[model samples]
Target: MFKNIKNDLPASVVVFFVALPLCLGIALASGAPLFSGLIAGIIGGIVVGGLSGSKIGVSGPAAGLAAIVLTAIGALGGFENFLVAVVLGGIIQLIFGFLKAGIIGYYFPSSVIKGMLTGIGIIIILKQIPHFFGYDPDPEGDWAFFQVDGENTFSEILNTVNNISPGATLVAVMGLSILLLWDKVLSKKGKIFQLIQGPLVAVAVGIIFFVLTQNSSYLSISSDHLVSVPIPEDTASFFGQFSLPNFAAITNPDVWVTAFTIALVASLETLLCVEATDKLDPEKNVTPTNRELLAQGTGNIISGLIGGLPITQVIVRSSANIQSGGKSKLSTIFHGFLLLVSVILIPKLLNMIPLSVLAAILFIVGYKLAKPALFVQMYKLGWKQFVPFAVTVFGIIFTDLLVGICLGLVVGVFIILLKSYQNSHFLHMEDVSNGKHKIKMTLAEEVTFFNKGAILKELDSLPRDTYLEINLLKTRYLDPDIIEILDNFSVKAKERNIDIQLLSKRGVIENPSSFTEFFRTRPKSKLSLS
Candidate 1:
């Protein structure tokens, strides 16, 4: 983990900066105590990072689960009750890891996965727009098109435009300009630029801007424009912030429901993070999914034991970690340590950071994820891939994340079935010999009940007064359901004045009246009609 300390340290710092505001923002969004997010971040970075098999994936309290957390907290009666669920969720995740459920992540199509990344990227960009203008309504965790506070995303942007704070806007613009300049122009110019990371530079400039505007009453900027880290004046007061969960409510059935919710959402979010982090790795390191599940489970358990929220491998921070040149898990671990130390020791320093400046950094992140090029590329892959991809993108943009994915998955399955039906042997046209139109219907490798509709359609559509040839040469396994379909088609074909030719290993037979009965007890063979 420490093999690349030189590169990793800088990366850790960048991730640290990116993670700080997110930790606080997610906590605020969850309606949990503000420190809960930081606790999760610390645990995710230190505990999960130390245990994770992933070299580049960064873990934290996820914005994706903010809705669940919010609802769970209210449903369970308090934040403490929710913590019980979080602990149970960790236990469930551990079992999932042991069961190897994490392998499900491997089954997603590359196109769909890419679409997910692109979709998230677009969401990040859209979400950060308000933040860039110093307008924070639902905090940093709410990224959906419709916010929990009943405001449309686009409308919120319009509202933010009308209420833009001049000081925050100026700092944000300057911060963004510095970040872009450092990344696009300076970073490539020389060693000096490489040494000073863009996000770090942007954040430092934001802090200085806040400090300079401090005493100026005439300045439009106020303390609210800066980062709001909770200040603990002394060592005694520092430890007083942690809130212990009420363990008496642990036996409630509602706790279990909340646990399941967290487990499923956190696992899904973690799987996405794993996939995304893998893509972001310049060296292309593959994180073991099962191990990652275990790591996340452990993180959650530890976090819940303390006063923290449930945790997952969050892509936002992971992507930032990679983009900033994080080379190892150590970078992730150090970032967590930084969060712990900063909040306790140097919160005043952290508080000087402007929320708008942080928003600017995330805006860049969101833009990269959902660039227009992603759509064009997906479309070029053909409709089979493009249709599902497009559906997912639109669904996510219009609705919530899970709903959009379900819609896309449903459409994807329909397309697959359609393709299967189109390729079914029943639809293939064959040539005729002599006066007999030899319609050769080569059964599929595996014909099942789902192919019934296509089989019936083809048989009913057979031209009248034509000889139809049906070949079961390539068929390895034909389900009983499909056999019934063939039997029905044969009867219909005869009535339509069509001749049916049957070919099998036994020999060639012309329109056997009892074709279905003949194959009823047919023994399975690798080369059935070879």
Candidate 2:
């Protein structure tokens, strides 16, 4: 890790700039003490980073859990009680890691995973727009369609436009321009350009703008436009900040419920981050999902103990890390150190940097997640992959993240079943034997209940008085329901005076009287088509 410190240090600095405001924003959203987010960020960087198998993935208090955290804190009656749940949630996740439940992450379709990243990117952009303009009614990191404060996401945007702060807007525009120039122009310059990141440049411009606007009467910028890191009056006050859980509340069933909720949701988000980060890795290194769960679990437990928000493998910070050229865990560790050092040495300076500048930073992060090119690329992969991917995207955008994913998963399964039905048995006319019309029915491999409709249609479509051969040799597994359908078809065949031959592991027999009964008489091992 020390070997790449030169490269990683710069990357860490970029990630630190990005992570700082988000730490505060997410803490505000979680309804925990403002410093809790910082604690989680520190733990995510230091603890999770140190233990994690992932080289580039960053862990932090995720926006995805803000709603749950807010509700849990309320239901548990206090932040301290919620802390207990967070710790318990971590222990549960650790158990999950030991159980090897992380394998589930690998099963998600690549198209859906890509869509998730793209969808999140789009959401990040939409969410940061208000902040960019200095309208921050919701916390800086909230990313839901409906905010915890009862405002619809789109409605909040309209409200922000109407109530836009001119000073904040000016700072935001300036910061954005600086960031754009640094990336689009300066980055192309020479060794010096590569040494300084866009976020750092934008931040410096933000600080200078703050100084220039010190006289609020003359300038559009005001104190409200500035970044607001929680200020502790003294060292003693900072130490007094930590909250202890109400052990009495731990007995409440609701506490346990909240714990399970955080455990499940946090685990899911971590798995998603692991998947998304692997895609962003230039080396194409795979992250160990189970180990990631363990790392997250340990981080969350430590965070809760220290009165911090729950931690997860958060994509926002991780993506920022990747975009900034982070190569290893050193960047993550350094960013954590930065969090600790910033609060101790430069809390006042942090408070002076405008919120709009941080919003500009998030705006870039969001753009990277939801770029339009991602949509076009996914569509080009074909409908089988695209439909589910689109569904997940819309589901997340229109509804909530989990709901959208469930909807997409359901639609994806439905399509798979439809395809199976289409590929299953069908009727075909064979050459007439001595003018006696002959028909053939071919079964698909691994026939299941999903294929019953197609099989029935083919069976019913046979011409009356035609000789039919029902072939089951190719089928690997036969559904009992399908066997019943064949039984009924055989009875109907006799009534229609249709001649039929049955082909299976059993000797080829002509006009079997009872399809189900005949199958029962055959040896069970021999009858299994596979």
Candidate 3:
């Protein structure tokens, strides 16, 4: 980790820039105190990042949990009460880790995972569009399709058209231009360019523009449109922001319910993010999921103790770290330190940076995650893979992250069932003799109820006066429903003047009196293939 400090330090700065607005915005959206988000960010970075097995994945106050936090805070009656739930949720997550439930992350299909990254990318792009144009109704980091402000994503974009701020638009365009130039041209020139990334330069340009245009009414960006970190008047007031959890709420059943909810949701979101981050990791390092859960649980416990919203491994910050060339966990830890120091020391300077600049940086991140080429690639994999991927993307866009993933999982499972049904058995026509067909049916390795319909269809469609051989010699296990199907089919075969040959490990039976009876009564006997 120390060996990559050169790469990690600059990357941490980029992640810190990305995390700052998000921390504040998520807190604003969650209806929690603004400082709470920062505390979570600080803890997520330093504590969770220290304990986590992931080298690249970063943790923070997640936008995914904002809605849950908002609801829980209200239901629990206050932020202090909500803190109790957060602490308990951490304990539950620790239990989850100890139980080794991290294997749950492996169960998510690759298509859905890709779709999630793409979906989140698209969400970031869509959500940032308004902020790019200086529309400030929604906070900087609110990524939900339906916002707490009563407007949806697209509606905000549309409203931004009418309420566009010339200053913001100018700054955004300049910010984007500077970023593009830095990425494409300037950054390749020398070590200096590489040391100073595109996002940092874009931010510098945004601040300079803000200062220069202060007197120009049309070009001056409003305070609301700028990055707003809570300014503490003094050290005491700053420390005053921290609140203690209400231990009295621990006895409340509703607190336990909320804690369980947070644990379940935060754990799930963290797992999903871990998957996404590993996919994004250039080195392809695999993070220990169980350890990540333990790390997150610990972080959440500390965060709750100090009046912060729940924390999760966040894809946005993680992706930023990767995109900005973060090589190890040091970047994650350094970013947390930056979050801590910046708030303590240079928050006033941070407040000068415009939101449009950050939006510009995120636009690039979003584009990389949901590149148009990825869609084409997924489509080429065929509908079996594409459908779930597409559904997950659309679901996340129209609904939310977890809902979209569930929808994708459903589609993925449906595809699996369809394939299983089709592959359950194979039919081969041997020859035609005396106007009669000899058909051999081979059962798959494992036959389940899903395969019953396909097998039944084939049995029912067989021509009359044919000799049918039912081969079960290769099948390791068969569902009883399939055995019942064969039993019923034998009766129908006799009516159709079809002769039946049943071959199994129990030997051959020609015109067996009863299929079920033969299987039940016959002892295992090896039959020669010859």
By descending lDDT, how would the candidates be arranged?
Answer: 3, 2, 1
lDDT scores in order: 0.81, 0.83, 0.92
- Residue-level lDDT tens digits of model 3 in 49-153: 999999999999998888889998999999999999999999999999999999999999999999999999999999999889888657765777887778898
Over the stretch 319-375, how does candidate 1's per-residue lDDT look in tens digits?
A: 888888888998999998999889988898888888788888887777777778878
Clashing pairs in 1: 121-369, 121-370, 122-370, 125-366, 227-353, 439-469
Clashes of each: 6, 3, 0
Choose the strongest candidate by lDDT.
3
Q: Is candidate 1 or candidate 2 better by TM-score?
A: 1
Residue-pair clashes, model 3? 0
lDDT of 2 by residue, 1-530 (tens): 78876668888888888788788888888788889899999999999999999999988888888888888888778888888898889999999999999988877767667767777777877777777777765677677787777887788788887777776778788888887887789888886887778788888878887787777764555666666677889989988877766667778899889889999998887887788799988889999889988998999999988888999887778888888788889999899999999988899998888878888887888787788887888788889989999998887887767777677778788888999999987677878786668888878778898988888887787777789888877777888898899888888988887888878767577787777778677654443333
Sequence-dependent TM-score of model 3: 0.96
What is the TM-score of each predicted model, taking all chains together?
A: 0.93, 0.92, 0.96
Error of 1 at 130 (Å): 2.1
